[model samples]
Target: MNRKIELLAPGGDVDAIKAAIIAGANAVYCGLETFNARNRAANLTFDDLLGVISLAHRYQCEVFLTMNVVILENEIPTLVKLLNQLVNTGIDGIIVQDLALFHLVNKHFPSLLIHASTQLTTHNEGQIGFLAKVGATRVNLSREMNLAEIKSLTRYAHDLDVLTEVFVHGALCIAFSGQCYSSSVSVGNSGNRGRCSQACRDEYDITAAGNKFPLNLKDNSAYFDLPELVDAGVDSLKIEGRIKGAQYVHTVVDSWRKQIDKFVESGKLLSDDSNLYKVFNRDFTNSFLKGNLTKDMFIDNPRDNSFKHANDKSNAISVVQIQEAQQTLSSDKDAIVSLVADKVSQLSIEKISLSLHFSGKLNEPLTITAVTKDTTVEIQSAVTLTLATDSRIDEAAIVKRFKSLKQSEFELLPFNFDGLESDLSIPFSQLTQMKNQLLFKLTKREYIGAVTLPALTHYPKLNTQPTLSLLICDEKDVDLCDVTDADIYFKLPESFKVNDNKYIDIFLRNPRLIPWFPAVLIGKDYLESVRLLETVKPKRIVSNNTGVAFIATNMGIEWIAGPFLNTTNSYALLTLQERLNCAGAFISNEINRNQIKNIARPKNFKMLYSIYHPILMMTSRQCFFQQTVGCNKPSIEDGCMLKCEKATTITNVKGISFAVDKQKGGYPSIYNHEQFLNIDAVEDLSHLFDEFFIDLTDIGSGSKAKIDKVELVSHFENVLKGITESKTSLKQLVTISTNAQYQQGL
Candidate 1:
């Protein structure tokens, strides 16, 4: 028989867990108080987790513990202890974001299944294959993927014996998951670490009338796409909210449960998502799953809005909302829970075959034998039944007594005393006692299965005294970067000429030149360009995608990972080196300076110190300019207006400015308020980085027009020399950024 798709639910607290089980979820995934991505949620304690596991198991459901945070080096000791303690807690699987969890868990407790979190930023088959080879049983594909992408990925992952999971409902991030850094830049708190300030929900001036929420993508509800996803062989469908209250969770889960059941039976989704919208939602966008690359995915005029208020900006929910929702759940909880219990109590799975030996004589004791799938449990009552004068214990009466197992978790298979009289007298109280003993013995055993993990063979080495480099966006900007005393790192934009050799001559002269690939490539065009550029054999290759890592590994070309791959924790950094064949990496810019310090890998491991490029707030396949001006294409050549070349500014109501810079390719990336200039602070961490790079893609000092080649080269040259010489005291230094606290986090 084909296994049905697992109905998974989110459990933020004990109440949510119970509600999910009651709502008919086959499995529940939740986080504990420590080492989870939802650190801000009311996560469970050890005792709470134990209770949750026991409760879910009692109802024939599984519990998966969340350890999806990118762990720091210092946190490893605590994590080790936590995993060891959780070994016997009846946790069926571990949902993780860090590679170290794979290493540590596989080394010690090999029985648990590892799930790769969405934070890992895996989009391609290469990334998914790497995780599966390293021991990921299931990989949660990125929510940004279209249906075609999901189908292709699911097919590939299935070949490798890995299950695939996707998010089907709830809020969607404007930026890609794990690739966003707006929170870190705006609030000095990292979203990857679960302290997001919801910077995307902030209002930005998209029109002259008012500042609208342009960066906020509409919440996704792929209810109608369930059939297609099932056809694609998806193993699980996950709902997005964990911080939401129990009533919201219960309603959502119940709705999805009914919808899925109906679809499975009839091959179509049931109508009515009214309860879904009433509870909470941002209208709905099936764009990602539909592969609909259009601007309508966001809330435009605000008239047809799905949700009126900002329910996402803060996870610290209102007291009234919580109390109100709690009441709704309280009134309905008993009915829902009773329905679940009745359904569970009727399952024949809890039944065990029983063989009995009944003594017909007066003083002989009765022995009952019970057999579970793997074990045998036998019990005998201490009290003996006395023979009666007028009556005998009938087979029908004995079977009735044995079959009355309403309160027990086990059922005894039909059995008869072959040689006994139809009316043999027996003590009724003694018979009841024997039945109780049999129930306890058969239902209380835990799984004693052992899991073996593959041997780990790769280790990373650190590179000390890292050098300084520059990111040149175009050939025109190459001259500006050439005069600098640092190693020139050319950034191949997503919109490079398909068959041009104009930039090859520039890098050919400098063997030390490192070429940085765009974090995102539109379609396969730029990637094809990179394939053509490979004839030049770039000495130091920089990749942000694992597909590039695979090419580099096969060609024996040395490459380093960029943060677009989401290497927030040390384990991710190590995974790049050991598994992805990357030499070293640029730590995620989302992390604070303290996290960077504690994330020291092997000594001398190359860690990039990027002195703030135009920090990409978010990127999209559809350009907003084209959306407003009337165009169907994101590229300029496809009958589009060149809105990016003109003055395009979106300021928040608070008067903060954002520069919209659209690329020639389909990708349109939004830059932060100012050029991330953190010169003064780099001095403190100078020993940590062997190389520091200045980003000259968007601005020169303050404005885009003020880009003077000579001034930039001279200013950085002085800063680079003055760190050691101390005498260069920089005659032409730009003023230190006043908002240093935002850039230099503690």
Candidate 2:
């Protein structure tokens, strides 16, 4: 508390932004209707965002814009145009998820501060190093981390001069952020694209635990854990409610504001937190931060729990008492709304008003006095004005040249030309220079002209024919590697024993099996993985986790970025190859043919694609069986990750089902019912790739496929080898497959 901790609030709209500012928020983050994660929220327009930044700065509150969604190939031009305009807005920072943005901002727009979004799934120390290397000044830690984990990562980040922020109050996601594909697979709406359908909250058939909404978790509230977070050395305490209305934002931000103030002032905590309950929430829990993954963290209902909390707090047992409690809660909510409205009524986000007064003589320089209510700036043309008849500085020409000022924070009023004599002219270039100078003086920042990124050189494939690769996890399938000449990738588990040498011995014995790391690794698990990497000293490996990639890059080992890193645009490819020394990468399967066709590959870097694999819906550190088939353990234990091998299907009310599979030493994950088999990519874009990979592992199969693994590999290889008859045989072999994602790109 003694340290200056920032209180960051969410601004879904103009009112919410004003409410947070009036409620004593130190910073506010919001989106601008496009290229942000909260597309469902009432995001601000570009013009409104300019005014919001101006207003927030007046109150000493910083504004951070959210451009956190993955950028597609076609959107880069428009995104660059927006960035050019944003560099002059005095925005404090830009929160981003795409690696392409990091590369773009670091190389072209270095003046813009970059904050890594939670979608990056930053959990381990090496991931912090990775973010810092990629130019993130601050990082949003994954919500699943505990106090000790946070403290350790924060210390590491601080050593690198990077700040850390924690999500103290918000809705909790069961799956790790950026790793969830449940919405994308269930519907065409992808969470990565900010079109999540809330599949976790959908009604499902009752499980053995008698729960209908099993995947729903209680909202996260670390209100009482301020002291511990302070001890953890986090720089900011972020509140997540961009989807909530202005009233919710005001009430929650105000309550936390008072709590933070009291704690900072007296080092004593506030006990009453009833104000937070008056808003929308699914009850509240701090179990994740406590490192206790109990079943109680989940709520059977996903709606607002305020009414129930009130009735329980009032000890209402009878119907009349319950009715009275409900009435009181409604009245209190109304009172809060009225109070917030009154407080925010004093705030305004209107554009700055400007009045221009032009005065000049026949021989002196043409001077334009820019006047505002707060200040005035007088700028003159460099050259002396001269008498002219055909081209004079008239009101029509001057207004046309200065109209662009209205696009920014200033609104130009009617121009005044009475003091200036007619038939006096200056060069058009001089007029533009005066306008630029005036902008610099008014905004207190130098004007940045538009920048154009040079087009990357398109490298052609050295080998025209793409190679075939297969992925396998179990040692039983290792014998299949001898049958084909394709490269084999060995899948590693999410958890590792303290001194486990089982994987080390496997890699040492079979030099051809390349290690494939998963997307999520924390604390000891991450360290053990690093130990294996150092012990084996593999020539090459494929990694989905940035933490693992950072270690590999530091050790001078060749690494290929996995598809989960969400490589979509060309700049992301450049970031991996140029910055991280990555030798190869897999383009994301979330995009379609048109979106994939425009990406220019870097020289000497290989582009890989997955033509056949089971579609992963989500992965979680929490137990999925507790509310499904019913586990005897009250919570997940250390042994669960190394011992649990449970697989079950959860059917929704719409009659669609998804398979939940948990292998030993692996986190529980959900998979789409049908496997992904994109034969069209092979037929259409085979020339653009160097490798077409397939997962022959039984991780998500769950007794679905009866075909022999060896025969399936042969069929896929033959299809890739241009065997006319093998296409039909391959389709028949994998009957329950779809290529819908390839057709419906994000």
- Could you give candidate 1's per-residue lDDT for residues 298-363 as a string of tens digits? 764333242333233223278776555555544455555555455434433222344554445456
**Global Cα RMSD, each model:** 11.8, 1.4
Candidate 1, which segments miss by more than 4 Å at Cα? 1-3, 209-211, 300-466, 480-485, 495-512, 521-536, 566-570, 622-647, 699-705, 723-746
| Whole-model alpha-carbon lDDT for candidate 2 | 0.92
lDDT of 2 by residue, 1-746 (tens): 34899999999999999999999999999999899998999999988999999999999999999999999988999999999999988999999999999888988899999999999999999999999998999999999999999999999999999999999998999999999988988789888888889999988999888999989999999999999999999999999989988899999999999999999899999999999999998999999999999999999999999999999999999999999999999999999999989988888888999999888989999899999999988988899989886888888888888887876799888899888988888888888888889999999887777888787788998588898999999888889878999999999999998998999999998989999999999888999999999999999999999999999999999999999998898889988888899999999999899999989889998999999899999999888899999999999899899999999999999999899999999999999889999878988898789999999888888435767888888888887888978788878888789889899999
| TM-score (C-alpha, index-matched) for candidate 1 | 0.74
- lDDT for model 1: 0.65
Worst 10 residues of 2 by lDDT: 701-710
Mark the regions of model 2 whose C-alpha exceeds 4 Å error after superposition. 387-397, 422-425
